[model samples]
Target: MIKSVNCTSFKIERLQTDNGAEFKNTFLSTFLEGCGNIHETSIPYEHHQNGNIEWMDCSISEISQTMLIASCLPKELWPYAFCHAAWIFNRTMHGNDTIAPYEVIAKNKPSLLLLCVFGSKGYLYDHLFQKDLSEKAIFGYHLGEAPHSKGWLFWIPDRKKVLKGASVKFDKNCFIQRIPASTSSLSLIQASSIFDGSMILAIEKQDKLVSSVNVSHDPIHVTPINYREALASAEANEWNIAIEEELTSIN
Candidate 1:
């Protein structure tokens, strides 16, 4: 599948694989070589040699399995399941570097405006509605992220819609599987309160005693903020200090 996509885009470069029977045939080697591509084989029994592909496959498998269990989806649709898995995984930030794969590749934070809870109830708008269409919304499982658009991929069982795009809604009751199983072991570090200087610390302090650290100064608030609230909270400390000074002067 990957080979087909690569061939279509004329981006076929080095095709690396383990010493498997699939790529051992002379025909496969000749075809790849004819396309001016290098077919490199990794060392036998040494999985670390092909760490990149190995890691990717493991990530996909883990995510797909989790989604399948969560949604009770069948095995035949594992391809779609993995696509959804890959999309979400890409959106997630890596623990080692604190950078999402999408951001790393695209060089920007992905917009979650169209993100919705996985396995949530949503209404699919029907275009061909002559009479008053009372029942528009259908029950669906929020699978993952979308490929082409800024929308949540929903699996609507009622309408038999698979991989449907929908708007993002933040309801407490919504069943969202935003936490992918592959990243379950990963830990997110929350920045603590900033001190007098611009030094930042994690909410959970590390045992290691480092002389100095340069943590991310970026704000990490997750709630959807209105313009007024956002502007007001921009200088949180300044507002508090000003209020304190006013009270002190009055007293």
Candidate 2:
């Protein structure tokens, strides 16, 4: 939940839960109150208001089940599998719509060159190296895209670790479909930019710009225009003689 809040651009104005004792605790209530957000409780049996979250949870459960059966991976690794699932979902086209969520937000279609087959084996080079000695790389699964950059993401199988916020460089010649021995561990990764109130405001501004442009008929032309071509015919006549003289000299 903290990670979700950290990654998203929207502020959670309130958190409404059921009359479950876990949520009704004094400490949790005090925390919510101190955060200056409303905390409302719904009736124990009625689930209509919380329908959205309920549906989302069910969907995740279904996806996890399918992935587990297809990949033969354990349930403990479902969280990592779900991250790859989300990346695929964000990139795939849906029902009569050619554009994906990534395209809509970035205003350009992202290339799939960075994508790797999920669960496929790959190698990840460690960041550090010893003097006059060749450093070793770890064997891992080619997961998906880096959340913050235009690169492939990997999950080191030997170490049972997921490499976040880092790019992968594939060795096409020696690529295989199995994990290898673990090497020296790499440094901990961090997000390049943290989500803040100001960044959320900026995203809102971008949304407005996209919405405004979507409704217009005129194409937003970004190509550079030649000054000579842009000039009126009458105005261009003044420069015609100069051009003619230059051409004649070449002839």
Candidate 3:
């Protein structure tokens, strides 16, 4: 909370939250007291006290769900979808605002040139892992912009990991699909269909990106649930960089 507060340009005189143990802790109280900020709590189960945040949460949830349904990606990837939805929501103009909320907070305009559809077909070029005469690129689904670097973020179903890459190509015509079986392969189906209010031409590519095709039907891992998990992850370096970038952006 202190780190987040320090990033903001404005001074916080008072902070209000629910009567959760996370907020009513000694550690948080000590920090807030040292900062000379007042801490207040609303009655338990009284969600309307935080009306603005509640509305924002509902909006984000709806947007994320719609994105997942359109992409046909599993609900396990909802975190990425939620992040993408929030990113879009922050950049959009709301109410009587002339500029976006991001512009107001960051003091700069957000660019939409690199924005692509969620779960779009992506190809990550593998320079180190590819063998001679082997396929140079592997298929994945586009998640969003990389939080750490200027590259794009992708979810490779085959590797069961999230990665960031600069040399990534996206085929917006194709969408990701999950296979139920253990083995997975990409296939282009020939069909004329309407998807997400847009007319798709004949021979639409339905690339089956294998997420977690276990014989036991286990759940697929999406992302780290906490900082410790992120630090212990295979993409620990990337996550660390992302944490730094997030702090930098709020400042």
Candidate 4:
């Protein structure tokens, strides 16, 4: 749970849960209370009070399951599918927000250009220093992206470890499915994208049973507009070269 919390980019303010003894313990109670947080308990037999979160959990589960099934991956990989769902759920437009949760927190427009179908087959170029032209690359499954380094993460069978790198080519046609935009699912997707007090308020009011551990975000790093400018400059240079070639050909 602590590890999960540290993975987020938000500081949990208050916590609310059902009347579970696990949550009513002295250590957790004292810890949260001492930290000046309001810990509220739900009324007995009050599942509706926590409907929002329950619904969100269901949505995440469904998304994870769908991804796994779509990719024909094993059941043991449900956790990875969950992580992928969460990642996509955050980047997707939520409710009224014009931007994604990643954009709101990172303070930049999130780019989906690097996104690959979850669990799709991918290849990473070989880094081997061998002089002979041996096998140039290895095959792997696209796991997810690194939160810190923004590097691509892959599950390499040969390596039996998750590897991170920037160079990767993906075969996304393996698994192609869409997240249906329904009323409830849309709300959950958008609401979960938020990390501000607004989201907490919504969860607390529902008396949700989750110790959503959110971590503090480090820094906001955005690709400068100069990148787009550079693309335009390159296009202009190519046009000039084309024009000069045409004139030289005519001469």
What 10-residue stretch in candidate 3 is worst by lDDT? 202-211
Tally clashing residue pairs in candidate 2.
0
lDDT string, candidate 3, 149-202, tens digits: 677777776765667788987876665665444423222220111012131221
User: Residue 171 in model 4: shift from native, Å?
Assistant: 3.0
Question: Candidate 1, which segments miss by more than 4 Å at Cα?
Answer: 1-13, 19-35, 73-77, 167-251
**Per-residue lDDT over 63-178 for candidate 4, one digit per residue giving the tens place of the 0 to 100 score:** 88878878654445455677778888878886787888778776677787767777778888767644586876777777676656766777665544556777787865654433
lDDT of 1 by residue, 1-251 (tens): 35455534436688888644345445566778787889877753467889987888787778777766675443444555667677777788765868887786566797766554434445544433436745544445556666566666655444344544454343456554443344222122211110111212221122122112322235673211222232355565554565476467434
Which TM-score value belongs to model 4?
0.57
- Compose the digit string of candidate 2's lDDT tens values, residues 85-186: 776666777668889867865567867776665555556767654446675666666655676676656665445466643435565565343222233223
* Residue 172 lDDT (model 2): 59
Global lDDT of each candidate: 0.53, 0.54, 0.67, 0.60
| Selected candidate, larger lDDT, 2 vs 4 | 4
> Global CA lDDT of candidate 4, please?
0.60
What residue pairs clash in candidate 1, if any at all?
118-142, 119-141, 119-142, 123-137
User: RMSD per prediction, one decimal?
Assistant: 22.9, 25.5, 17.3, 23.9
Report model 3's TM-score to 2 decimal places: 0.66
